[model samples]
Target chain A: MPSSSSVPFDYSADGFAVRDDVTSIHRVSWEKIARAGSHWTGPQRVEIARQARAARAARNDPPWSRDALPGAEGRLPETAVEAARTIGADAHRIDRAWAESMIEALGDAAYVELGSIVVTVSALDAFGEALGRGHEPLPDAIEDGTPDGARLDAATDIGAYIPMADPFPGPNVGRALSLVPEANTLFFSNVMAMYGGPSGSFFDLKWDGPLSRPQAELLAARVSALNECFY
Target chain B: MPAGEQIVGFGEAVVRGSEDLPAAREALRQALGEAGFLEACGIAGIFNGLVRNADFSGIPLDDAALHSSEDFRDKLGLNDFSGAKNSDLSRADASQAGEGLFPHKGQ
Candidate 1:
């Protein structure tokens, strides 16, 4: 396998013109996952990603029957392990009580960071899957460091399980990761690259892409439903 | 909704990892050339994360979206989804509907 630094979101071999920003954002996400974050160590983050992948692979199976990952026994706390698995395969069913319990054990910031890692890796892998590329190998080496415990102090509870940055001038989804600003940047940067384009056309009724706005929305809505997402 | 059928089929097949994905991908590529096919793939991939972000964070639906979607939310059974509980639909009013997607923007 190519070294993580050499690995990128390259589609040239596949004969597609993926935007430059999209490729860059995806590569950055991979690099970030291999390093220590606000609440989790590098290895912990990577392990969380692995558990998420494992859970998603068993998505067809009932959660009760899904095999336990090595996370709890080795690096991650049991609460974090459960958070990764549930977020990866069954986020649609995640409720406030369950989330609060996990947060109580892992701390709200840690839980949010873990969720971000799971979703980041899942999104990257899903793109590959959509194009028949299968999964990218996880980073072979993790950066060595202790977590900084940096968290958004001003974050306030907005009826969500955890505190979030004060109401922002955007969709609630855009503010979803605000408690961890880096997490918000990590995920939504990819979102903007992949969908919104340079002018932030997500709100625009007309689009100039090869796919029309409706065609794009059709794909987006269908995928959201297939995942059983309510939002 | 011209190419909606093909787009939806491709999305369902890909997300499910179904055996039909190969066939669905080919159909979508034919309908929307190579560029559109790729963009579609990216959209499918990102929404996987988008949904998780929203659900995991427990963000309620924007009021405008809630009010605008009210008519079909129940009929389409969207109100039954777990995340629907985040938003109180009883507060969805016509005044809310007038605001565009980013009601909080510039305020």
Candidate 2:
């Protein structure tokens, strides 16, 4: 992990332009969150306002301890919310323990734990197919199946899982486990390749990383660049 | 790093879907750029895919013994709107009016 003293992150001139755009988007989102004032206290929203910049300063892969704060008697993971930033952290990471704690924090707040099925079977071949190479850590065994499609949010054109439906556990995890929820967990297990784990070690300081308002902005920009997301 | 370890909670939320869809989507656009927007949708679409499987497998709604949140479940639209209700469907109107046709998708 880079020491807290590392004052600069070498984003070249081009990187600056990209960073600026990401920042502007976050600003807009935070502003919106503040105005909304739902599911969070005004002070809570202020903390979320800091997530984008803090996550960025940590290079988008911040550690857990520095990233989360206690809420409602439990340490809620970064809300990482957008839409004007007063409610939750727009961009942040949540560990498994943290994931559990987040769900735990909900405390009868209308949340569901989607269960995840862990196929202890060898995933080396699967990883090879995904990356065309044999890697030590492999992706989980999850795929888009027929039955899974039936559950799409059909009633609404939005066709997305509603946030109100959130804090949902991994289908394969605990009570949330169903065959398809299991597959969903496997999918979550697989996409880590794109998010930068080992490659992002410099920032995954766990609890030792930066978690302040400015760091959130920096994290948001780095991810926006990597994902090429410009909303 | 474990695959689960990489995405973090929101990372999975990226695929599993976010606490707030449009806002999260918009936020991705801010952080990730246009592709990020698409990625959020793609990630979320996968979760939508699960709804059928979950309902089919006779998957029971999570028992309180597990994860519990009254506000989380029933209030699906609240979190995304920052607690505002999504009773209005302007996007649907535009689509029905054949307006812009999935502004997120490429022309």
Please report the candidate that would top TM-score against the real structure. Answer: 1
Please compute DockQ, using alpha carbons, for every candidate against the native two-chain complex: 0.81, 0.03
Candidate No. with top DockQ: 1
> lDDT at A58 for candidate 2?
33
TM-score of chain B for predicted candidate 2: 0.32
Q: Stretches of candidate 1 above 4 Å error?
A: A1-6, A14-16, A68-73, A198-206
Ten residues in sequence with the least summed lDDT for candidate 1 chain A: A1-10
lDDT of 1 at A100: 87
The 10-residue segment with the lowest total lDDT in model 2 chain A: A116-125
Q: Per-residue alpha-carbon lDDT of model 1 for A1-231, expressed as tens digits?
A: 222334566665455577777777887887888888888889888899999988887777898887554445678887788899999999999999999899889988898899898888878888888887677787744768888888888998787777888767777787788888777777877887778543455534336667877788888888988787777
Compared with the true structure, what per-residue lDDT tens digits does model 2 show for residues A58-141? 333334444442232221243322211211122112222333344455321111221111111111111111111221221121
The ten-residue window of minimal lDDT in model 2 chain B covers B82-91
TM-score of chain A of each: 0.90, 0.26
Candidate 2 lDDT score at position B104: 27
| Predicted candidate 2, C-alpha RMSD | 20.9
- Docking category of candidate 1: high
- In the range B1-107, model 1's lDDT, one tens digit per residue, is 77788999999987888899989999988998888888888888888889999889898888788888877788877888998888888887665576788876666
